[model samples]
Target: MSTPTQKHTKSRKNIRRGAIRLKKISLANCPKCKKPVKPHTACAFCGSYKGKVVKKVRVPKSLRKSKKQEKSKK
Candidate 1:
C-alpha cells in the first residue's frame, strides 16, 4: 500500500484553487441618460434600450446628438 506524501494547508489550497470571483460584464452607455448600462438590457435607472423608451428617461437636448457625427463629417 502507498502512504500519504504530504499535507496541504487551507491558505495553500485556496491559492492553488485560484481566486473565486465574478466575471465583470461590459456595460454600454445609455443613449438617453449617458449612464453605464448593460448591453441588450434595459437601463436600471431609466429602463430604456435602443430607440423605444422602456422607462421614463429625462434627457437633455444638448446631450443628445449623433455619436457618429465625426465619422460622417469625414
Candidate 2:
C-alpha cells in the first residue's frame, strides 16, 4: 500500500504527452489542374487522374461562387 505522488502541472502534462502534435500530410500537385491533392487520387478541381478523366467532380453548391452581370435598364 504505497500511494504518495505529487500533482502534475498542465504544461508538464502537455510536454509529456507531446505525441498529440499534428503530423504533416504530404500532397502532390495535380497535373491537370495544378492543385494540391493526395497522390494516386483524382483531381477534385478537374476530375482527372493521371491526365485521364476518371470521374466527374463538382463543387458543392454552397461553396460554388459565381459572378452575375447586371444590365442597367434605361
Candidate 3:
C-alpha cells in the first residue's frame, strides 16, 4: 500500500472533519403531550404521532409517583 507523500495541514484536516463532528439532535414538540420529541417519530411520553394516537403506553406502577409522595419529599 502507498502512503501519503505530504503532511495534511490542520485547516484542511479540520475542514474535512467538520462534517464528522457531532450534531445537535433536532427535536419537535409533541402536540398532544407538549413534550420534546424527534421529528417524524411517536412521542414516547404520550405515544402519539401527528395529532393521532399510534401507540398505547402503560405507565408502570414503580415509575408512577403519587402527589402525596412529592409533597412529603419537599
Candidate 4:
C-alpha cells in the first residue's frame, strides 16, 4: 500500500515519460508522376522508385489501345 502523496508523485512522473520526442517521416516527390511518396518506396501514381521504373501503370481504355498499337508498330 502506498500513501496518497506517493501515488500522486508516481503518476506525475509517468505523465512526462514520453513528452519530449517526435518521429520524422521522410517525404519525397516522384519524378515520373510528380506525386508525393515516402523515401525509398515505390510511387503509387507511376509505380517507380529511385528513378527506376518498377511497375507498369494503367491508362484509360480510350488511350490504352491507341498507345499499344503505336508501340507495336515501333
The reply for model 2, stretches above 4 Å from the true place, is 1-15, 59-74
- Which of 3 and 4 is ahead in lDDT? 3
Cα lDDT tens digits, model 2, 1-74, are 97749888999999989977787988999987788998887888889988999998877765553322222322
Q: In candidate 2, how many Å is residue 69 off?
A: 9.3
- Best to worst by TM-score, what's the order? 3, 2, 4, 1
Model 4 per-residue lDDT tens digits across residues 1-74: 96665445766777887576788887888888788899888998888888898988787798999999999999
Residue pairs with clashing backbones, model 1: none
Q: What is the lDDT of residue 11 in candidate 2?
A: 95
The superposed Cα distance between candidate 1 and the true structure at residue 8, in angstroms, equals 6.2
Q: On residues 1-74, what C-alpha lDDT tens digit does candidate 1 reach at each position?
A: 99869988888999977877778999889898789988998887676779567776666555555545755787
What does candidate 1 score on TM?
A: 0.45
* TM-score of each candidate structure, all chains considered together: 0.45, 0.53, 0.71, 0.50
59 Cα displacement, candidate 3 (Å): 0.6
lDDT of 1: 0.78
* CA shift of 71, model 2, Å: 17
TM-score for candidate 3: 0.71
Candidate 3: tens digits of C-alpha lDDT, residues 1-74 = 99999999999999999889788999999999889999999999999898989999988776666755887899
Cα lDDT of all candidates, in order? 0.78, 0.80, 0.89, 0.83
Q: Against the hidden true structure, what lDDT does model 2 obtain? A: 0.80
> What TM-score number comes out for model 4?
0.50
